[model samples]
Target: MTTGIAARIADRIRHSGPVSVAAFMTEAMFDPREGYYATKNPIGAGEDFITAPSVSQMFGELIGLWCAQVWMDMGQPARFHLVELGPGTGQMMSDMVRAGRAVPGFLDAARITLIEASAALKMVQGRTLTPMGVEALWLDRLEDVPDGPAIIVGNEFLDCLAVRQAVKQDGHWHERMVGLDDDEDFTFVMGPRLGMDADLVPARLQDAPDGTLVEFRPGDRQLVDVLGRRFSDHPGRALFIDYGPAQSEPGDTFQALRGHEKTDPLAAPGTADLTARVDFEQLGALARAGGLDVDGPVEQGRWLKSLGLEMRAAALIRSAPEKKSVIARQVMRLTEPDQMGELFKVMTFSTPGLPKAPGFAPEA
Candidate 1:
C-alpha cells in the first residue's frame, strides 16, 4: 500500500477541489494505507505525543483499580466485557489485566475486547496480551462488541475521532475549510455555512469575535450515544481520560504533533498526529439522552487525587527509596496542576441502574 498520504491528498485536491479541514484530517489520520498511527508508533519519545499508559505503569494500575471497583459494584458479573476503545500497544489493557488479577475470580470471569482501528497496533497488542493469558479480540468499531455487561475505557480516544472547524466572521459562524491560498498551499478558509444547529450555539459563544476559530466534535455525541445505549441495555460503566477543557469553551483546538513538537497541521498529511481537545459538556447531554448516568467534567488531577493517587504514590515511594523520586514525579505528572493535571480531564458514564463509577462523582 502506498504510504504517501500527503501526496494522495494532494491528488484528491487536484482532481476535485478544496476540501474541508475535517476531510483533510479524516484522510490524514485514517486513510488506512499510510495514516500516521496506522503506519507508525505515534506515542512517546520520537513520536508525536505521549498518552497516559505511555507515561507510566502506575497510571494504568490506578485505572485498573477503578475498573475493578466498578465491576465489584456491579455485583461481579459472571461474565463481563472489559472494553478499551483504543488499546495502543496494548499497554493499558495489559496493565489493567495484571492489576485486576489481584482480585479473586476477576480474570477468569472477564472477557477483554479492544476497539482498535489499526491492524498493525492489534498485532503488537496480541504479543502483549496473549502472554498475560488474556483472550483478546480487536474490532474497528464499538458496536461490534456484542451487547453485554461492559466496563469501557478510552484514554485519549475521543480527540482523534475527527472534528469540524468553525470560525466566527462578520457576526456569523462559518464552517472553516482547507483550500489553496495565494501560495497554493493548503490554508484555512471560511464558508458561509452554519453547523448542525446554530440556534443552540452555546450561550457563552454567541459573541464569537471575527477571526476566532473554534473546533468541535459532533462525533463525540455519537460515540457517547453508542456507549450509553450499549451500557443502558446491559448496564456498565465507562471511564474516559483526555486533554481538554472541563466546560464547553470555544477555541481552535486542532493541533498536530511530530517529533514530540507542535508542527504545522497542514504541513504533512498522514505523517503527524492530528487531534483536538474533547468537550465533556456536550458529551454529557448525549449520555443523558441515552438514558445513562453521567458524572463529572473534572480535572484529571482532582479525579486521580480523589481516587487516592497520593496514597499510591506515597506507598511506592516509601517501598523503594531509589524509585521514590520517580514515583513522586509520575504522580505529579498525572495529577499536578501544571502538567497533565489541569490540561487532561476525566469523565465517567454509567448505565441507568449502575452506581457512579469511582474517580468521578456518584462515588456512592
Candidate 2:
C-alpha cells in the first residue's frame, strides 16, 4: 500500500511526470519529515548496515593518529579545525580524540567540527562524545564549517551523495528517471536525451554500446569545488575512506540496505540506506584541478597496515589476552583482501607545499 515517503514520492511523480534518479534519491534519503537519515541512526549491527568505525576502535584510533600527523605537518598550528563528515554516532571521532591525546596538545589546539544532516544521528553522536568532554560544532553541510587550517576526514560518507544515472539507448544517452509501472510500483525509465553541451558521460564511455548505464554525482563536483577553494586559501588536508574502484568504470552501483541485507531500492522508499560506489579517480582529478595535492586512492587494507593496524591489534591483544581471537578477527575483517580491505579505498587531499599525509607514500 502507498504510505510514508513512497506515497509522497508516488504523488510527486504522478503529478509532475517521471523524476530523475537523483531527485528520487534526494527525496527518499533527505526529505525532512520521512527520509531514512532524517528519522533514524542507520549504523551499528542493529541498523541498516555496519560501518568500519563500529567494527573496531582500532580504525578510529588510527584515523586520529593520522590527523595528528597532518596537524604536525601543518607546522603545528596553534588552533586548527578537526572535522569529520557524516560521523556516525561519533564512534570514530571518539576513538580519534582518544588517540590524539598521544600527541601532546594536539586535541587541545583543535576544534571539533562535524557535518551531519540528521538530528537523530546528531543526538546519538552527542551521547557518544559528550562523556569525553568534547563539545562539537554540528553543521548541515561541509561548506558550513568555518574556514581555517583544518584536518578533515570522512568514512563511508561520499557514497551517500545522490547520483544521477544515464542509460545509452539507440546510440544516444538518456537520463534515467523513476516512474510508476502497471502495478503502480516505482520503475526506471529513460527520459530525454542529454544535450552534447551538457553531457557529463565520461570520455571513455562515449562509445559504450547501447544499454550501458552510468552514474555520476553532482554533489561530488560541488564538494570538490568547495574543498579546492578552501585549500587554495587555507593550509589544510582531508581524507576520505569509501568503497569503490580506484579507476573510473561504468556500471550501476545504486542499491539499498535494510537490516544488513540488500533490498530492492525502489521497494520501500525512505526505509533503506541508499548508496552508490564512489568514483575515486574522478574525485582525485577534481582535487588536483582545484590545486590540491592528491594522494593514493589506495586499498584500505594497505593504508591501514601502513598506519600500524597489526601493531595496534597486538597491543590490544596484550592488554586483554582473553579478547585475542576477537581482535584478530577484527584485524582480518579490516585488512583481508576478501573483506573490506580490498573493497574499500582510501584517499587524501592536501594543500600544495605540504608533504604527503600519514599512511600515504611519496608520489613517484
Candidate 3:
C-alpha cells in the first residue's frame, strides 16, 4: 500500500533535494499529520514495537520504587516533578505511582508530568493514568515542564529521536542523506565531506574503514544537556533505559519496524516506525559536561536482578498461585541474559551532592 507520506516525501525531493536521514525521521515519526506516532498507538502485540514498561507491571513498579528512593535522596522534596519522556500509554507512570505508595510521602509529593508528543498516545495515557488518581500534565517537550526537583524516566525513548549519519567515502566522512532513484524509490546518497572539527568525528573512529557509517544524535545530546542543566540548576535526577552499545562504536543502527518486525525503512515513510540505537557513551558524556553526576550504563538484566526483580516476581506469583508460570515468564523476558537483559542498558544522572540511585551501585 502506497502511503501519502511517501508521496509527500517524494514531492519534497522533487522540489528541493535529498533529505538527511534525520530529516526523514523527523517527518516520518513526528510530522503531526500522518506521522507514525501521530496516527497509531504503536505499542503492544498489535503495534510496531514493545518497550520494557509494556512487557510487565514489574518494570514500572520497580522504576516507581527507584523514584521513591530518589525522592528520599533529594531530601524528600515537598513538591517535585515525576516526569516520563515518551510515556507510552502511561503504564510506567501509573505503575511507578502505585509503587510509590509504599514510601512515605512519595506519592503525595510527586507531581506527574508526561512529555509525550503524540496526541493519540496522550489520550491513551490519560485513560491509563487517570484511574490511578494521577493528574498528569502532558507536554510535547521536556523544556515545557516547569523546573523543580524532577525524577525523570525514559524507557526506550532515546532510540526514536532523530540522528544524523556520517558515512565515510574515499577516506572522508560525508553526511548520509535520503534521495530517490530512477524508480522514485528512496536510497542513501552521500553529501559533502565534513570540515576539520576535532569533535565532529570521535577520535577512535577518525580512521574508520571506508563506507563505515557513524551516527551522531544532536537532538538526544541537546535533550540530555538540557536535563543535566535542569538537574544542576534545580535538584533532580534522570534515568534512561534503552537498547544500544555501552561504548561508542562506528555503525549504522538505523532501521524501520512494522508489526513488531523489521521492514524496509524506505518502503513506507510514515507507516513504519523508524529508530536508531541510543549511544549511551555519548549521552553520558554530555550529561556529565552539562553538570550532572553520571551513573551506570549497566546491562538491564544485571540492574534489574540487583533491584530484586526475582523477588518481585516471586511475590506476585505467591499472590496468585495460578499465574506463577506467567509471572515467571515475564521475569525471564525482563532479566534473562539471552533476552532483554543483555541487549538493553540502564543509566542515570543527578545533582552532584545526591547519593547514587538504587540498583546501579558499583561493584563491591
Top candidate on TM-score is 2
lDDT of 1 by residue, 220-296 (tens): 76787787678757868888998887667888778898888898998868878888888777777667877778888
The top-ranked prediction according to lDDT is: 2
Give the poorly placed runs of model 3, Cα more than 4 Å off.
196-198
Task: Tell me model 2's lDDT, rounded to 2 decimals.
Answer: 0.90
Encode model 2's per-residue lDDT on 71-118: one tens digit a residue.
999999998899999998999999999999999989999999999989
Q: Give the better candidate number (1 or 2) by lDDT.
A: 2
TM-score (all chains, Cα) for each model: 0.93, 0.97, 0.96
Ranking by lDDT: 2, 3, 1
Question: How does each model score on lDDT?
Answer: 0.80, 0.90, 0.87
Candidate 2: segments with Cα more than 4 A from true spot: 196-198, 362-364
Clashing pairs in 2: none
As a TM-score, model 1 comes out at: 0.93
Q: What's the residue-level lDDT of 118 in candidate 1?
A: 75
lDDT of 3 at 213: 84
Model 3, 1-364: lDDT tens digits are 2888888888898899998888999989998889999998998888888888888999999999989988888899999999999999888888888888999898888888999889889989999987888888888889888978898999999999998889888878898889999888999888767666326565567788888889988786778778867877899989999999888899889999999899888788888899998888888878777777889899999998888898998899889999998888898899888889888999998889899889877760
User: Which sections of candidate 1 miss by over 4 Å?
Assistant: 1-3, 195-203, 362-364
- lDDT against true structure, model 1: 0.80
